[model samples]
Target: MTIKNIIISGASRGIGFELAKQLCAENHQVIALSRNITPLQALALPNLHPICFDLQDQDAYKGLVAYLTEKQLSVDVLINNAGKIINKPFEDLGLQDWQEVYATNVFGVAELTKSVLPFMNKEGHVVTVSSMGGVQGSMKFPGLAAYSSSKGAVITLTELLAEEYKETGPAFNVLALGAVQTEMLNEAFPGYKAPVSAAEMASYIKHFAMTGQQFYNGKLLQVANTTP
Candidate 1:
C-alpha cells in the first residue's frame, strides 16, 4: 500500500484513536489531533505524530498549518472525526448547550477543512464523520436535539464543499454512523450494547479514508447496522 500523510481529529480515544493507531501501524504518516495527546504519545510510533488540539479553538488552526508547513507534508486524507454530543431533552436544552455541540461538531469541521485545503490536491479526500440520527427521515431520538442537529449541519456542509471543489480536486464525503460500542455511545445511552467495536469501525473507516474517494464524492454513506 502507498504511504500517505493523513490527519485525523479526536484521536485521544474510541474510533478516532483506533483509526490513528491502525494507519500508523500501516506505515502511513498519521497526525493525530486531540485535546489530550497523552494516549497517542504513549504509543511512541515513529510514523504517528500527536498534536494537542482543541477543535473549538480558532487559533489552533494556525499552529496546525505551521506544523504541516514546517514538516513539508502535504495532506492526502483529512478525517474530521471530532464531535460533541449533548443528551438533553429539547425543552431542557439551553442555548449554551446547542452552541457547545455545534462549535465542535459543525464549526470546527468547516474551519479545519478550510485550513487544510491548501495542503490537499485533486487526489486528497475529506471524510467528515456524522451520525445516523443526523440523517433525514432516520429514526429520531428525543435527547439528541442539539447533537443530531449539529451532525446534520456537517452533512450539508460536506455536500456544499464537494460541489465547490469539484472542479479543483479534493473530494469530500460524510459518513453517517450507527451505534458503535464507544465511550460516546455509553454516555449517550447507558446499558446499550452496540454490535460494532471501536477497532472494527476504525478498520472500516481507515479503508474508506484511503480509497473511498475513488467511487464516492458529495455522498452520505450510512455506516451503521443498528441505531441507539
Candidate 2:
C-alpha cells in the first residue's frame, strides 16, 4: 500500500474537493475538512474521511487531534487549501471584510498547520494553494485587494515555514493557481471566465506534488491557465 494519509482543508467543493476526490481515486486516504461536515454525494470516494468544522473555531483543533491520534494517523501530506476571499476595492473593503478574509485564509490556516505539524512525518509534503494575484503585477479585475494580499501572505508563510523546518519539514510550495472555475470566482466575477477546470487543476497539482522536486520548494509553482 502507498503512503496514503493526507489532510485536505477547504474540501467541500471547488479545487479542494476535486483534489481530495482525485487523490482518493489514486488510492490515497484523504482526510477532508470544510465548514460543512458532510461529504458531497457526487464525490463518492471510499477513501475519503470527512471532517466538518469552521477553521476559525479554536475548539475544532483539539477534537481533530484527538481523533487523528486515536486513529494513530501519521500524515504524509498536509494540504492547506482552506481560504476565503473578499474581492473588493481596498477603499471599499471594510475592516470587517478584511478581518474575515484573513481570519479564514491566513490566521486559521497558520493555526491549523501549527497544530498539525508534529503529526507529520519526515519528508511529508505540504502544499499551499495560492493565487497568481499574489505574484507580480497583474492587470486583473478590480476588488482583489483582500484576496491578493492574503494570498501573498500565505506564500510568505509557506516559505518561512519551509526554512524553519529545514530537513524535517516536508518539501513545501505555494502553488499560484491561475484562473480556475470555482464558486468563489463565480460569486465575485459573475460573468468572468476561468482558464481551467477544478478537476484539471487538481490533476496537475497532484502530478506536480509527486515530482518532489527540490527546486520547487520555497518557490511558486505558477500553474497558468494552460496545462500547468
Top candidate when judged by lDDT against the true structure: 1
* Model 1: lowest-lDDT 10 consecutive positions: 219-228
How many pairs of residues in model 2 come into backbone collision? 1
Q: What are the clashing pairs of model 2?
A: 88-143
List the global CA lDDT of all models. 0.93, 0.81
Write the residue-wise lDDT of candidate 2 on 157-189 in tens digits.
988988888777677788988888998889988
Best by TM-score: 1
Q: Which ranges in model 2 have alpha carbons more than 4 Å from their true place?
A: 41-44, 213-215, 226-228
Question: What residue pairs are clashing in model 1?
Answer: none
Tell me how many clashing residue pairs each candidate has: 0, 1
TM-score of 2: 0.92
Residue 89 lDDT in model 2? 78
Residue 61 of candidate 2: its Cα lDDT?
88
Off by over 4 Å in 1: none
Residue 193, model 2: lDDT of: 87
Give all TM-scores, in the order shown: 0.98, 0.92
